[model samples]
Target: MNKKPNILLIYTGGTIGMIRDFKTGALKAFDFKNLLEKIPELQLLDCNIDTVSFNEPIDSSNMKPEYWVQMAEIIEDNYTLFDGFVILHGSDTMSYSASALSFMLENLAKPVIFTGSQLPIGDLRTDAKENLITSIQIASKQENHKPLIKEVCLYFEYKLYRGNRTTKINAEHFQAFASLNYPDLAESGVHLKINKEYLFRSSLNKNLIVRKNLDSNIAIIKIFPGISPQVFQSIFNIKNLKAVIIETYGAGNCTTEAWFINLITQTIKKGIHIINITQCSGGSVIMGHYETSRELIKAGVISGKDITTEAAIAKTMYLLGQNISGKSFKTIYETSLRGEIT
Candidate 1:
């Protein structure tokens, strides 16, 4: 018989870790050490599970680069000891965390799944239990004693999505996320069916390497109708800004106005990397394909292709951390690093 997989459950803080006080109707942190007590269903899985919680739980809104580094460190420290890892985090920024981790962990050969619940676990009708249980199952899945998934993924609402391609689309619904440009990695229904063709195939000989340095000195500028040149210039001219993600119109088209083109050109000349991504959810960025976007391409803006905004930001930070030059940075940004873009 094959040895059962060892799964690490890292609870960073979210509704999944909460339990309601019946009398006071207050939600409090449930001790994960007694995981079985809260979710006895976990014992049903054919794997050994261990739990870890942050010393101080944080809301997703406060998640930062330092936290991403800490998460990477934890996985790095425990890389060889476990078969897979499931992170319980707030859904508000789960995509950002998952996307950041995708870039941080290179040559990953085991599943690193992030999951969280929209409702508290203590609630009778909460989605927490299913999300948590399935995430663990997907992480522990193996074929020929090798991990079935070898990349960062997010499991929610019976669907497993590529971490970097996902975006949180709803706050009230259980289906809070959608991978606008990528297909679902796996879906849970009568049985857990993985789209093996879509799975990331890592170079088996490569050892896992964790990237620690991340540049948070980046900004996102979303273009809108009647946007003022002063406002655009102010953002583009931020001091020490290393990168900017310009959310452009459909098919990566933007204003053909002279001032806008001048600002972009000047920004690029100053060594500030600019990435042009689509504002629409379901399309790829096609820079220079349209007359409106011709100026942006001429101004040296990098095309983000089909990358989600979350992934674009993470990719920029990852590339900036490498300290590459402007010309090379654009080349790397346009390429697919971890299935974040086409």
Candidate 2:
């Protein structure tokens, strides 16, 4: 028989890690050392689990590349000793964190499942236990003795989505996340069904690589009606700005006026990368689909295709930090590096 898989639970602070003091109705972080005591159901799983948490956990809003680097290093240090990893992060910025990690971890051959709850684990009606439980179950999934789910993924509300493709769409519902362009990788039902065809199978022959450097000198420009040239120019001219994700209207369109194109063209000449992403959650950016967007393409605006704004920003930072510049930078940025774009 095959040995039980060793799963690592990296708790980076989120609602899922808290427990309530029922008497006072207060909540606090649970002791991971007594994980079984907190969640006895874990002992029933068909794998062994070990957990590591951040020394001083912060809300996901405070999550940055430095924390991302620390996460990568933790996984790298324990790569061989574990079979899969489940990250507990705040859902508020989970997509960005997941997308960042997807880029930082290259040729990942094991699952890096990120999950969190909309409500505290200690709350009687909390969604934490199910999300946490199912995530661990998915992390332990295997086939013919080889582990399944060899990529960054987000699990919540009975669905597993590609990490970089996910976006937290709802604040109150249990189904808080969505992967608009990509199909669900797995779903939790009576059987925990996995769409085998959709799982990303990397070449195990390639050793895992962690990218540490990330550039934060980026901004996002969301185009709106009657946006003044002064306002647009201010954002575009931010000091040392390396990249910008322009959230255009439907189908990657924007103002067709000559002045807009001139500003875009000038920015491109100055070595600033501008990515065109649709504001709509469900459609790909077909730059030349409309007269409005065609000028952007001509002005050297890179297409984000079907990627989300969160993924776009994270990817822009990642590519910029790599020192990839000019046409080569655009080419690489336009390509789907982490299955982020469909």
Candidate number achieving the greatest TM-score relative to the actual structure? 1
Candidate 1, which segments miss by more than 4 Å at Cα? none
**lDDT at position 89, candidate 1:** 98
Model 2 residue pairs with clashes = none
What digit string (tens of lDDT, one per residue) describes model 2 on residues 181-293?
A: 99999999899899989887776699999998899999898889998788779988999998888999999999987788899999989998889999998999998988888
lDDT, model 1, position 56: 93
In candidate 1, position 120 carries an lDDT of 93
Error of 2 at 177 (Å): 0.4
Candidate 1 pairs with clashing backbones: none
Q: Give the TM-score of candidate 1.
A: 0.99
